[model samples]
Target: MSKRDFYEVLGVGRDAGERDIKKAYKRLAMKYHPDRNPGDDTAADKFKEVKTAYEILTDPQKKAAYDQYGHAAFEQGGMGGGGGFGGGADFSDIFGDVFGDIFGGGGRRGGGQHRAQRGADLRYNMELTLEEAVRGCTKEIRVPTLVNCDTCEGSGAKKGSSPTTCGTCHGAGQVQMRQGFFAVQQTCPHCHGRGKIITDPCGKCHGQGRVQETKTLSVKIPAGVDTGDRIRLTGEGEAGEFGAPAGDLYVQVHVQKHAIFERDGNNLYCEVPVSFTMAALGGEVEVPTLDGRVSLKVPTETQTGRMFRMRGKGVKSVRGGAVGDLICKLVVETPVNLSSRQKELLQEFESTLAGSDAKKHKPRSEGFFDGVKKFFDDLTG
Candidate 1:
């Protein structure tokens, strides 16, 4: 039987671009693939026809000869009569070229054998006190991970014996199969793509190259490290397979909450409580800082919520810059557990100041009342 024109089989013009040719071939191949069509002989035949068309069209020399002489180029032995369905061109090759990677066939070459791979990274969460974070400290941590076995030297083979080359792929790690008009390469299933087989496996690790172990690591935390800061330790992670390079370990910092102070960037804020007498008549008081306590002078007639700034009293940033200041907000504390005599004296003092206008001493309260009055007036009107 005479064969159809290659371009006609793929539904592409003779002058179609390479990309267009590939697209047309892919569409037809997918439609008639043996896997998709099952036992449909017609679809399988169409798939072979499509693959042969693509194989010839994609090759510059083959395509030129066919274009000039048609099928006569191969029939007269000009391009080899058995070339279309033999040699590198086959059905397996077509499927591997298109679907092998998706199906886990496109791995490190050598018959699908497993190779030495990098180890997995690890994370260690470290909790830091506010003072420690602001001042910085060196801490020791114990981490459990997989380490290369010293008994077998990470080979996973017994003493005096080592892994042997895979017979299935002959140490190439991959095997080629012809499908339709193309050659497809896939990992060797017998060796699991490792290209090597261990005859005598180590009893300690059961043919695995690593074992569980604990290691101590010292980490230096720079000053001004806030929450969510991470410190990386290279090559401190779990051991890799078959003695591959180790992975990294990350130390994540979590800053503990402070009882007296809150941090905002490099600044520190604290609420300092003062007696009503101190707020009214001003005095010097001790304020706590990360370094030590310092004296802060309260001015006469100081109001509640007044902030006092102490320069260079907060944390120094890890990233080099000017030291931050400590801001203290004053909160007036009412006198509690007053005696009868003290209460009587307070009553007398309250009566003495009663006739005076409260607005002069409580301007904010007076302004709030004025706004309420205007709101009611607007509603009534």
Candidate 2:
């Protein structure tokens, strides 16, 4: 049978917090516990399911993977195989892993009694002009985050006073509880898994072991970076908890809209307006590019919507490809706001086109009129 969703199994929403998840799991476990259910096999299976769900949801790393990939994250060949809680695994170990402090149980100690929690990662949304994105630039940014407390050197205790071992769990950071035939371990209530209590808290950090402050950092942006690209600044995020490593800072890039140019991959596109005289007679005109103004030769009898490509005049890809071309789409602009002399000159020019070769001179216009005449004839017929 396909497994039910962990959130559904615990009867909680997807956004349920740590405390809510624990409380829900405890309620379900109590109802379906083998000790409470006696000889019911269904209840025992349910208890296993609930335990598996709680184990995955409570651990931040496991929960992140599960949230991203769903059940595939814990499958045998899928993510890491049944989340290391399947058949033949010790139930007591599973019990000890999560509920240790709850049941007043202690595990092996390390160099530091305080927990070494990783710092939170940070992201800075950076907006750059199109030209700046095409070319590399260095910038400085300010970010507000947590840093290690200097008063007690991140120990959280007042100067000259250190933390004492938890009296509840005896430095095990967990406690064991026996309910019927099962034993469960839970976090120590007194020390809350640090296994130590601070008699005097630091005045500077107020026992939080970190302070909030704004930090200035330098970021170098590489050329040809596009939207959604990010530059990683290692160890530039918030300070780690209890002397652990700091997280990474990611500067996400957003390119501002350009006035004249639109980019596609390494290529660039722009519309250049050509006068009717230039389109008909053909002449050299000045066009704008990133490299500055350049002369573009318009061929004789050039039509509107004709595209011209300038080679090696576009963007060089940040991902290392050939330099792209700039394609200019030509739009022939009709003359407007004519004076009386201009109108008389146009009328004289129109009279000159009344010759029989006029049809040959305007083949596209004659062909379109012919097609329209045939359409009306076919409809009447």
Candidate 3:
């Protein structure tokens, strides 16, 4: 019988791509498979035709020959046989490409696979006082972590009787499954990818290979570190499986709020209250900083909310930068409680200031009243 055209056999166009050819073959093969249509002679023959067409078109070398010379290329007068082109070819690779993940096949067919996994990282939050953060300190902290089991030497085996090779996978971490023309390799169920079976488990950690322990470690905090800063301590995290590299521990720093100062980046801000007399007639006042108390000079006619900068009194950054300034914002305080004699003296002083014909004492008050008078006149107009 003259064979049908390979494209026609798979119900795909001559310009169809490799994916289209495979899809068509898959549809036809499933519809007329011998197992699906048992005892049906026509279905069995149709399955063979579809399989042969797929075998030829799927091979680049054979497909090229068939495309150029037609069936004559594989006939007795030419390239030999087109009907059985994939008889001894490697179908495992092609089958794996389509059905590998579903059946757990493909690259894992080899028995030995990596079973050890990296340990999980850990974090520890540390709170420090503003003084401690500025000066730096060393503290001993206890952390609960997983340590390798000494009884089993981290192998998850018994002290006397060690683990044995898995009979199901024969020490290979994976097992093979043959489905039609494809081969799939999946993790061994018996060994769970470890390739070994612990008949007798360790007494300390059972079969886990690691144990929980509280470890004490000394952490050194550097000076000038603020909130949200992190210090990393390598290999101080949970123990890895089967002796793999351990994870790291991150120490997160949080600085407490200060009573005397507000920090902005490297700078420090503080509000200092001054007596009205001291502000009006120039005097020296005391200011607090992280270092110590320093004297700040209040100039004559110094108004409220005047910012006086004390350089080099603020924090130096942990990441390296010039030391910042301490900004003291002045606030004028009104005096309270006056004796009878004091009140009489204040009344005399007030009269003396009112009698003056100049704006020497209260220039700001005179200017503010002048603006207010003009605002009312405009409204009336």
Candidate 4:
């Protein structure tokens, strides 16, 4: 019988791109794999046929020759038959492209199958005072993580003994099983895919290669660092198993609430309370800031809820820019617990001013009443 077209076997067009070819192969391989299909000889044979088709189509020279002369190019005594392409040709090159990485063979031959994997990253939450967040400070934090054991130097074996190659896989880290015409690769169960086993376990770490420990590290916080900012400490996280590269430590910042000031981006907002007398007759009052208390002038006739801006009084950004301003909202506080004499004096002052058109003195109140009257009239109508 004549061989089928490679593209037709993989269910792809002849002009299919490399990605499309790979995706088609992966889907077919997964579906027809012996382990998945179980005892189905037809699926196994189809799997092998697709694998072989993919191998021929993906190679530049083989694809070119096959395109020129069809199946005759790879036949028994054809042009490519005798020179390195005959019956003794190794199929591992094609197998590596398809199943090597998935089965833990490191994708290709002579690439040295396994090395230590990088450690997991860690996060540490740190609380900072508003003042400290604005000014920036260095803090030492203690983080619990896995560190390599010193006894066997991360080898996970006893001092005198070393790890041995796995007997089940013979140090290949993977095993191949023939089901019908198809070859399936899987990780070695004996070594748990590591290809090596420690016969003499380390007493200190119990052959785990790492130990639980607390590491104290200093992190420098930049100025203007707000809540939700992170400082990364490279190579400060958990130690990798078997002496792999260590991961990073991230310090997540949380700024504590300030009693006097609230921050919005680079700007600072604060409510400054002044006596009613000070609001009526201008005076200098002290206001609190991140740095220290500063004097702010309350202008005469300053209304309640009026905002005053002080340039360069807010935080300097951690990302670097011009310093922000401090916005102080003035709130007039009425005098309480007045003495009898003071009350009498205020009553006399009120009596003198009473007949002189209260609407002129309280224009906002008059305007509010006018608006209420108009709303009632509209509702009635």
Best by lDDT: 1
The sequence of per-residue lDDT tens digits that candidate 3 reaches over residues 1-381 is: 777888998999888889999889877865775555779978767776777788778889978998998888877656654334335433334344444432343322333554688788999999999888877899789999998998888888889878898898888777878877545577888988888888898889888889999999999999889999999999999999867778899999998898988888888899999998899899999899998888999999899999999999998888888998999999999878978998898889878777455367778887898899999999998
- The Cα local distance difference test for each model comes to 0.83, 0.82, 0.81, 0.81
- Minimum summed lDDT over a 10-residue window in model 2 is located at 103-112
The true-versus-predicted C-alpha distance at residue 114 of model 3, in Å, is 3.3
Q: What is the TM-score of each candidate against the true structure?
A: 0.72, 0.72, 0.70, 0.72
For model 2, the superposed segments whose C-alpha errors exceed 4 Å read 1-114
- Superposed Cα deviation of residue 328, candidate 4 (Å): 0.3
- Tens-place lDDT per residue, model 1, 187-240, is 677766677888899889888978999999999999899998899999999989
**Stretches > 4 Å off in candidate 1:** 1-114
Which residue runs of candidate 4 sit more than 4 Å off their true CA positions?
Answer: 1-112, 378-381
For residue 177, model 3's alpha carbon misses the true position, in angstroms, by 2.0
TM-score of 2: 0.72
Clashing pairs for model 4 are: none
- Give per-model CA RMSD: 13.1, 9.3, 13.5, 12.2
Cα lDDT tens digits, model 2, 152-249, are: 88888998998888898888765666775445565567887778788789999988788999999889999999999989999988888767788889
Error of 4 at 175 (Å): 1.8
